[model samples]
Target: MVGDDFAKLFRTFEHTAFRLEVRDRYDASYENESLRKFLAGEPDDLPWIQDWLTMISAATQRGLRFSRVRVVSLPLTDYSRFGVWCSQFTNGAGEDIRYLPRPEATAAGLPNHDYWLFDSCILVRMHFDDGDGFLGAEIIEEPAVIVEHNYWRDAAWHHARRREDFATEQRIERY
Candidate 1:
């Protein structure tokens, strides 16, 4: 499914929509312009960010929690740095975004692929290409898979640091 479908699913979740992002970089076409600007040391603003913030705010206002744990490498990639900068918007909008260094995430046995677990049940496994470009998502409903994802989410969240704290500790400037 496309991202819009995921957004729709977010609106339907009753309690939580948790995401585990286990990627060092993403090369989605839509993000190219913003990524380029960030690499050039320009302001981290992206035109599409407000729309996402609005969605997150709306969900959280309804008492539905939205959170994500991003697994990043030590000497962060440009993409990861950009993500750290942009996270302030999401965090401000009430999403509890966190970051876990790759080494810690791997040692914790977190899954290699990215996924979104909604309401602690449905799992949407996100697929990407060799260059880390998004392909699509598979909606998995099997109880066993969902259970494992829940476990991974719990582990990752436990080991992760809130984005603000992580950024400060790592000396990552927002702009």
Candidate 2:
């Protein structure tokens, strides 16, 4: 699913595997806000990301799997709470998708690509800038790229801080 526009891009997939790797707080915020607003009784203002979340929810309702991975510069301020809710829409029987810190993600050798990289045969991405705009990318049928991204994910996974469970630190939601 590749398109310069979000509507066209998302419209191409009704049921397909998605391995998403987002790199920044804004990216995470955009996605999280879009999904959370919809789930929390707000109207679907950002229908694009919300639809995917809805799809994941529907799949879970039908006992299917929806996979995802989030790579961010820092931990989301309220990941634990968000995780509990997001679990209702994932491949691991509603388990929270893995969240990897940027350094960890870098260590994992996760392929770092611009927004366009998501259009490859193995990944999907929504591209945005600090200006609060949006676009989409998809990568399918690209094994080498996927392998690279996989390694990156591993390194990221190991380096990401699961600080949510630790009592010594306080997280300030900077976004």
Candidate 3:
């Protein structure tokens, strides 16, 4: 399954793990309890979050770069806001997180789907349902596809603002 593939890739990648996330809201299964707690104004002290942070930190300490660009729309949705809140933990774990407004991302011609590119070679295109529930991922190893995704990543990265800067601009209160 693609889920297992993602875990394998995450553990075995040699250099960089880059992700481009382009969704406003995700299904309940994708967010469940943490999102509920966040919406209810609870502190972000979730145990699973710490586990993810530990994984990211270990990867970074091994010299593997982790970065992500999240494309968001104006008048943020609840999920987007939660994502911004979660960015604090990920950024602290040495993952470079950034934000790109949807209008800007559209203007730059980036794809609408989400994907993960590992070491600028293996491309894993992620699928989602109409309601934004994760479906799965498809691994694409073609040179041309990889090259195109690499180009998109560079462009998106260039236009995205760092998480801290974006949080300040968006007036998102950091916990």
Candidate 4:
């Protein structure tokens, strides 16, 4: 549902003014074929995905200064190359960085325990359920909402364990 909005949003925000605070998986489901394929080492990199990375890399070049990167939940494994991607945008010194998970859901709940934060931006959740019973969201933007979800992610992060083994690999750049 949000795919179209994201498509348009991506185009608008792909430039310097726009920053991201991704909470859940950056690329999840077959719907995000461009990102998934690129992550899977497919030959073609999606233009939007590439643009997204380019923005992040550009932000990094500017000393990793973004509005914010609040990670709430990470469906993707911590050991995955995704961490390497995060590092490229978050950690520049190349030192292993361990996140400080919130002990509980913050007063402002969004989603994800990992909690990627950014300021002065909008969010759109793409609900991909193949059922007429549900109205899948194509774009969602509201303040004082998504509190329950954000709480859930915070709870999970508190209970979640860090992937020490994967963190080691990240330090070595094996991924």
Candidate 5:
């Protein structure tokens, strides 16, 4: 599942979904304007993630749950700060977003790969370039692989800090 087939999982996952984000920076075409504003220290006139918010809102209303843990460095990068800003909108719309310091995650032996595990069954392993640009994604449904990723998701979730708390701890509100 590389294109539409891959996207269908978002609409079809039965109950839950978890994401493990290990990159300190992500470059996506959709976030270009927001990233620019974040880098230039300017305010965004409108939310860039309206679509994601709407999707999460609808999914949660339907009794579906979504969560994610982002492993980040101690001194947050500009992109990490921008991620904190974006998490605000997503969390408000019913996504559980958390931050895990990279050192702690490394200490725990969590894999550095990024993926989305749906309903503890299917996985979409994301591929990205060295520059943090997304290249493609592959869907995996092997039971053994799913089990391994489930363990990873649970480990990350157990050690992560909620969006607001982590932001406060990092004093991101000053921005």
Candidate 6:
């Protein structure tokens, strides 16, 4: 249930891969340069990011669904702003990326933890340190747990707004 092992699930899912991102920031090494550029008020582009974008593009082209709902706080963090910026590319590549303000997500009774639900079956819970460094992934196979995660996914998706719409709103609020 480590990062590499968890990633293999992406290639094996038959239909859908849904992610519920509850963290305001992820300390993934690959994104550091992009984050730097974002903070410097420069282009958000990072060459290595193309690898993930390509993977997403390929998966969607093969007819699989890719979606994620990020639960963010009202006053956006620098990382959250960067996420909105990156969503443009990810969403354009056919992944349905959405945002849910923390208050709304709380009203929907969503869990604070982050996880990925694959084909409404396997639940991969993400573990991270206080510094936002990813620790590993924990795979859950119980039907009851899967059902609960699935319910959370549905609730989050219902309350989320597409990236395009949310980005505009964030720009207006600038919070």
Candidate 3 backbone overlaps, count: 0
Query: 52-81, model 1: which lDDT tens digit per residue?
Result: 899899988889899999999989887888
- Candidate 3: where are CA atoms >4 Å away? 28-30
Error at 79, model 4, angstroms = 4.8
**Clashes by residue pair, model 5:** none
- Largest lDDT belongs to which candidate? 3
For model 6, give the 10-residue run with minimal summed lDDT: 166-175
The best-first sequence of candidates by lDDT reads 3, 1, 6, 5, 2, 4
Model 2 TM-score, 2 decimals? 0.49
Off by over 4 Å in 6: 172-175
1-175: candidate 6 lDDT, tens digit per residue: 7856877998899999999999999988888888887888876556867987898999999999999999999899998998898888888888999999999999999998999999999899999999999888899888898999999999999999989899998882222
**How many angstroms is residue 32 displaced in model 4 relative to the true structure, after the best TM-score fit?**
13
Clashing residue pairs, candidate 1? none
C-alpha lDDT values of all predictions: 0.90, 0.47, 0.90, 0.39, 0.89, 0.89
Q: Show pairs that collide, candidate 6.
A: 76-175
46, model 2: CA deviation in Å?
A: 11
lDDT of 5 by residue, 55-167 (tens): 99999999999999999997998889889877887898999999999999998889989999998888899999998988889988688988999999998999999999999
Task: Give the lowest summed-lDDT range of ten residues in model 5.
Answer: 43-52
Listed in order, each prediction's TM-score against the native is 0.94, 0.49, 0.95, 0.37, 0.93, 0.94
lDDT of each residue in 9-118, candidate 3, tens digit only: 99999999999999998675646788988999887576667877998999999999999999999988888988998898899998999999999999999999899999
Locate the minimum summed-lDDT window of 10 residues in model 2: 166-175
Instruction: Kindly report which residue stretches of model 4 are placed more than 4 angstroms away from their true locations once superposed.
Output: 13-49, 55-82, 89-121, 126-137, 141-143, 146-175
Give the higher-lDDT candidate: 2 or 6.
6
Number of clashing pairs per prediction, in order: 0, 26, 0, 22, 0, 1
| lDDT agreement of model 2 with the native | 0.47
What is the lDDT for 139 in model 2? Answer: 44
Q: Is candidate 4 or 6 superior in lDDT? A: 6
RMSD of each: 1.4, 7.0, 1.3, 8.0, 1.6, 2.4
